[model samples]
Target: MIALLLALGSSLAYGCADFLGGLGARKAHVLRTVLVAAPASLAVELLLWPVLGASFSPSAAGWGVASGAASAAAFALLYQTLAIGPMNVLSPVAALVSAVLPVTVGLLQGEHLGTAGLLGLPLALVAVVLVSAGHGAGGARPSRTALLLAFGAGAAIALQLVFLHQTPPGSGVAPLIVGRAVSSAVTLTAAALLRRRLGPEKPVYAVSAAAGVLDSVANLLFLLAVRSGDLTVVAVITALYPAGTVLLARGVLAERIHRGQVVGLGTAAVAVSLLALT
Candidate 1:
């Protein structure tokens, strides 16, 4: 129960962070948002390290660096998609893919899905399709490019999740530092290559920084949850982050949902519940 609660909290924190991140990217530059967020996130982990008693392991650091690169690309594409696409449609597709990919990875790692997991998996896939099929007020569909980018982001996210889990024991936040540093470098390079303005207004900086803090917290909780339970379970729970993101978009952005999306949400809820009991 504690693990489940932690996973849920992680999902919410991740959702909130992604919401703020998408907003920041839309208002400023996509790479700039990530550049600012990475160091801020790293700072929080650094602050926590003393009390947490971190260790430095080369293997863990390498794993983190690899994961960082994948995650950087993922976030960049995701933010770009969010900037131009309907949040409700893109988020659920990305979330579903992210969940499914890691579960596949876990299975390859010799973790067998129980009966509930097998039943829930198909339902979640159906939810993903229904949510993606939903159109906004004018029946405008997301561009094919945006959907492709979202799928790429999901694949990258799966790589990040798997690599982060492979971090050596007792490394603590050292791996996080390495990972974020690598990610930051990639984001900065991408920003330069794309000729994006890196400087944002003071107010935007606050939003970006807050996004970082929330992300750091979310990642910590995810790691904790993974440590306490099955990786497949934790990954699915964390991928449910779209739930919070969708709610926030509706409330703050006034995004309208389709009837199919409502049904999709119900299916997602049933799927999550079944998976939880697994």
Candidate 2:
């Protein structure tokens, strides 16, 4: 239950990060947004590193770098999709792909939580899809490109969870630091390759930085959750970040909440409860 709560908190933080990152991307180049976000995220982790007494590990570092690069690509593609697609289409597809992969991986790794957690998995899955559903009551469709990018982002995100959890507990902070550093470099290169430029917008940098920091912190919390709890449950719960994002959009962006979202939220709550009891 503790681990589940931690995962839930991580989801909320990640949702905030995604929202802020998207806001920042609107004002700056995608790569630029990542570059700033990466370092800011690194700094936050570093602050916690000493207190947490996290040691270093080359293997962990390698995983972090790989995960970071994947994340960078995911972010870039997600922003590009957002620029040309609808939220209803992009968000759900991405969230579903991301959650499914890790859940599959967790099962493959011999992790099990009995019937309750098992049942919760499908509910969590449904929640992510429904929560990400757009404004249309019947069937609002988004651009195919948006759907594709969202899937890509979701896949990348799932890979990230797999890699992060595969790291040994008590591994040092080196993995996160290396991941951020490599991500920054890779994102910058991508920006150059794509001919995207950093603009002179302050809000872009500020929001991107905030997003990065929050995401980094959330990642750290996720690692801690895994260290202390069942990876299967943790992954399922953490992957529910779309719930937080949708709520924020409704509250801050005044985005209309559709029936699908309400259903999704209720499903997620039930899943969390079942997972907890199990």
Candidate 3:
């Protein structure tokens, strides 16, 4: 139950972060937005290090670096895919793949689920897809390139979570700190390389920074949740983040919530209840 709550918190944080990040990206280049966000994320992890305590064991460091690289890849690929999107299809495809990969890995690693969990997991996956379904007027279908990038992004996201889960329990928040550092460096490097292409539009610094903070919080929560819960359950629950994003878009942006998303929100609630009962 505790793990379920933590995972849900992670989902909420992730959703909010994505919303803010998207807003920031609209004002500036994606890489420019990331320039502000990545360092802010690293700063949050650094602050947490003192409170949470950390041990930079070699295993932790290695896994942290791996997760960091995966995170950078995920960020870049996902943004590019969205830029080239038929978003309604690509978003759900990425979300579903991210959830499915982690769940599969968890099961392969010997995690077992109760019957309720088994049922809930599939429902949760479906909910992720539904919640991510965009209500935008029809656009051109995504190119094959966009589809491939979406798949790559999803796989990278899955790897990030899986790698984080591989860290030793005693490592504290060291892995996160290390991962954030690496990711920050990668983001900066990419920004530098693309500076010429980045337009003159000023970034929404405050929004981007807030997004970073929330993203850090989300990662911290996910790390804690996975340490205490079955990875399969935690991953599926976290993947339901799109529901939170949809709700925020409705409440904050006054965007219309589509019928599928409304149904998805209900399905997600039921799925969570079933998982909690296990």
- Give me the candidate number with maximum TM-score: 3
**Candidate 1, residue 248: CA error in Å?**
1.4
Order by lDDT, highest first: 3, 2, 1
Tens digits of lDDT, candidate 3, 1-278: 99999999999999999999989988998788888888899899989888998999999999999999999999989988887888988999899999999999999999888899889989999899999888653666778998999999899999999999999999989999999889889988888888899999988999999999999999999999999998899998999888778888889999999899888999999999999987
lDDT of 2 at 181: 75
Across 39-101, the per-residue lDDT of candidate 1 in tens digits comes to 899899889889776677778789889888988878767767767777657766776788788
lDDT value for candidate 2?
0.78
Model 1 Cα RMSD, 1 decimal: 3.0
Model 3 TM-score relative to the real fold: 0.97
Each prediction's TM-score versus the true structure = 0.84, 0.89, 0.97
Q: Highest lDDT, which number?
A: 3
> What's model 1's overall lDDT?
0.77
Q: In model 1, what is the error at residue 209, expressed in angstroms?
A: 1.0
Model 3 C-alpha RMSD to native: 1.1
**Which candidate do you rate higher for lDDT, 1 or 2?**
2
